[model samples]
Target: MSVLVRRAALTVVAVAATVLVAITPAQAEPEGGTKPLRDALRAASQGYQDARTAIANAKKREGELSEEILASQARVADLSAAVGRLAAAQYRGGSSAQLQALLSSGSPESFLDTAATVRYLSERDGAQVTALKAAQATLARQRKDLDAAILEQENQLKELRKRQDEALKALRSAGGGDPTLGFGDLPANATPAPRNPDGSFPSEGCSVKDPTTSGCLSPRTLHAYNETKKANFDHYVSCYRSAEDGGEHPRGKACDWSSAAKGFGGMAVGAEKDYGNKLAAWYIANADRLGVLYVIWFRQIWMPGTGWRSYFGSGDPSSEHTNHVHLSMR
Candidate 1:
């Protein structure tokens, strides 16, 4: 009887195992019975990777273009200096005494030679001035083109980030456990505010000096910068207003701050000082609350250190801010 019971128990265990194997749960399928979303997300990731490559290429191109622009500018400056010297010489020759010295030669051939030399110098001076002007114009156009390209690449990067964020969100939503998974844990109500009438923000009041106009600022860009500043400030205030809240604060401008530097009028020392100080003060005021370990802004391109520190009478502090949180609004 004991042997019979042992065999019966083994048979029952095998039958249960077979039933469990035969009735396995179905694998989960994503929504809509289509795999297009997953495919799209993969494509978007690839596109983001491509965008990073494009950004690197754009930066290299910008550097090359900037070097060319500088070299061209230096050539123009040299030509300008040469022209100035020649003009001074011509002016000195205009005096009656100098003219007499040139003309009152021992022989006609000597006088002709002196006259020919003066004429040659004048002709060369004129040619140099013309060449300098042409070079300046060409380099100015090239710089403008490079600036536009940099802006374009930056915008493309922003778009890529947006798409990547969306892709991540879609993947998380499809994966199903937490709705917020893969969607960066943003505040529940983190929607950006609409632009006010006149396309300005109430919190922003700074004006961007105009490069084109003599003393006036660019109203349009000034307004835009102010709005961006306000928006960034608002984001920061919203995120880190309290220690209990675990949100990220704004660390940089929404768009490229370097672009606004162009509208800072001429290369006046005081204007740069004032703008730099204001930015620094703003950072300092919210530094602790915002958890901003470091903030860097490269006027020309992205670099290792705090561009602000260099501006603030400090040695290069680029490497020091590496451990701090990195936030790039642009």
Candidate 2:
């Protein structure tokens, strides 16, 4: 075949292969030795994140209510003082003073002016009283809401503790012996995922097309993947596997970033380990922004509430996650 014809044929074959991957059902789980461990990590991480969001929302509401209550209280105090002064003036003046003013008027026009002035003072005092009442009512309502917010914060704290305990339990069951000095912080930035008005992540589906694989990813996962590339950590990445593969991969809420430039390889060491460390630190630093559930790298895992714990999977690089950084999103 001519060179031009051969190039066209190869292009067609590549397109066909991509289509096949897109349509192919996920039949087997990836990484055979780590299914149970991945499952536990997902459960613990997700629960901790939910509790953390709730607590943050409750704290924000509490702060707002507090500010409003302070303003309301100040208004009420000022109104009360104004009303008190009006009452004192009325008591000191008494009816005698009004009658004397009317008697001293020299003409009908003068008497009419005195009467009008008396009515205006009474009406003004009444309005002040009304305003004071309204301010008090508003203050009461705000205090009640503040109380409820406090209660909500307390309840969410309890839930947070429960989730933390569950995470610790998961670590113990997974043979994670103790906390380790995990990857340290490195300066990295990621575009924040869109959130609900209350600062919670919006529920998403496997809708966006995964760039690395033909499978699909949630919009959040896709954003995280792109942001990682922007940070110049681009290596090999695969996201959106079959749900049958387990954990967030099938749900399109996770990605596996290989340390090797080409793909997954043997245990990452030296520069490769450094790469994984930086990547893991970047995810942790941007966890809240990206709604990260957990990050697993180099035999350690980081969750929302639980910082870092030893995580050893069945004896293999994939299971141990020594060769890649695993990121799971909320």
Candidate 3:
């Protein structure tokens, strides 16, 4: 072969190797064959996270209301004291004090002055009484609001428990025998995804372009992908695909991080297994901030409420997720 042609061939091979390390080849079916279980996991995970967020918000509101009630009570006490003083003055003086003062007045101007003073005192007492009533009413309303907030927190806790149970049951029904003490010594924190004003993740569509494939991914998924890369787990990843089986793939809210550099192969072992473990643990640690619904890796799955449950996939590497870590986003 010519020297130029040989160099060109070498360059093409290098490029091919790089591409293989960056993405998996397109396949007809999704890796795992647990569509029903995945769907159940998604629903349960989302509900559980929602319940948690609601409970947090309710607690914050309860604190605010409690503080307001305390302030209102103080105001009511001060006003009540002022009103009591006015009542005591009226009781001691009676109308006789005013009449005596009017009788002693030597001129019409002095009589007018006394009358004006009495009128001013009467109006001030009435205003103080009105303020006391208003303060009491405000305190009552604040107490009611605090009660409602407490009730909401209780309801959300119940819902969170319910969702946790559902997730556990779904896994068990699909042959999840017991929880696994998943990977340890997780990597450091990832950059958080954008959130709404209230600290909750905002709704996202399949908006951003997928870097691995000529498809699209939600902004949250892309953020996860970028963070994973930043964590030095830059293996082959595939995020978006049109699957008839119905999962986050079609919605651009999922990504599969291959354990092997060459692509999805046999079960990851040794260093590759360690790589997958660290990646999975990182996702779990940052699940709340990343808007992650669930993560499946090496025959185990992690959801929000449930820590890590056994996951039984079809009898293959892809189905078992033994060679990749699958992430589903909310």
Candidate 4:
């Protein structure tokens, strides 16, 4: 090969080696083949939220500083007006004003008091004006600092969003935009999850008449939900949670049947584990017909073609699905 071509090939090899070194085995293969990418996306999302909060706080502080600056300016103005009037009167009448008061005094003590009052008033006004001036300067500096902080926060948010988008792209590549990735080869008849009559899952099901979310659910999700209710399972089966603001839950396409009554935690090793497993298996078995996208239970995740894989959530049973059977649809 020519010298130029050899150099070009060497550069490419160097870049490839750098990438291989930077990406760990877990990242290359990913935990459960996709968890690493999902983890990256989650970190990025949290960073975005943090950056937004910082920006909001900075703005609030900036507003407070502005108010302080305004109040200080008013103080300085009032001080100036009072001092200015006193100065003008002194300049107009000069020492004669004090002499006139001194002559009107009926006694030596009264005359001395008139002269002392002039000196005391002038000194007090001067000291107050000086302090107000310093305070105004301090307020201005504080406002400037807040402005810089707000700008910095804005820049950080922009950068975080860029990273968030990159993480999402990597996650999409790892999961192929499909929640059902692990249960093995797709059936020739496999199809997308069922959508609502209006296309996206929404509030309406069983009787849409119930006010609390416990009554609302997507029609297809409700089918599985109603079935679980009858399974006489050891755990409570719940659907249509109203607390969540986003994702499949609020949309009525997800449900959580948890054994933990108060909080999410590991289930007792015997029947609870068995119940969770059965619930998971049932969903996987009926996935095709029921439009199931994925099932999470017993600290594992199952998706079409991907089979069962150990789940690594944020060290929480709720997140790991260890104490609950979390089901989601298309």
Give all candidates' CA lDDT scores. 0.41, 0.82, 0.84, 0.58
Which residues of candidate 3, in runs, are more than 4 Å off? 1-23, 26-33
lDDT of 1 by residue, 163-258 (tens): 556555544454421221110122222223343443222332113442322222223333333443653532111111111112111111212122
RMSD values, in order shown: 24.0, 7.3, 5.3, 22.3
Judge candidate 3 at residue 91 and give its lDDT: 89
* Candidate 4 lDDT score at position 54: 59
Winner on lDDT (2 vs 4): 2
Q: Which wins on TM-score, candidate 1 or candidate 3?
A: 3
Query: Judged by lDDT, which candidate is best?
Result: 3
Give the residue spans of candidate 1 off by over 4 A. 1-33, 93-102, 176-330
Least accurate 10 contiguous residues by lDDT in model 3: 20-29
Q: Please write out the lDDT profile of model 3 over residues 8-110, one tens digit for every residue.
A: 9999999987666434545313645467876878889999998998999999999999889889989999999999888887789856787788789889999
**TM-score result, candidate 4:** 0.43
Best-fitting candidate, scored by TM-score: 3
The candidate, 3 or 4, that scores higher on lDDT is 3
Tell me model 1's lDDT, rounded to 2 decimals. Answer: 0.41
TM-score of each: 0.41, 0.83, 0.89, 0.43
- Cα miss at 46, model 2 (Å)? 3.0
> Which clashing pairs does model 1 show?
210-217, 305-318
Better structure of 1 and 2 per TM-score: 2
Query: How well is each residue in 1-330 modelled by candidate 4, as lDDT tens digits?
Result: 999999999999998776554322111111122445544544554355445545666667778777877887787787778768767877898458777877899989987898798678667767867876786687678777867977877796786667556544544555433333332332222233454443332334444422224456666676666555555543544455544434455556666765543323454356666666666766777675566655666456654433565555455456556667777664
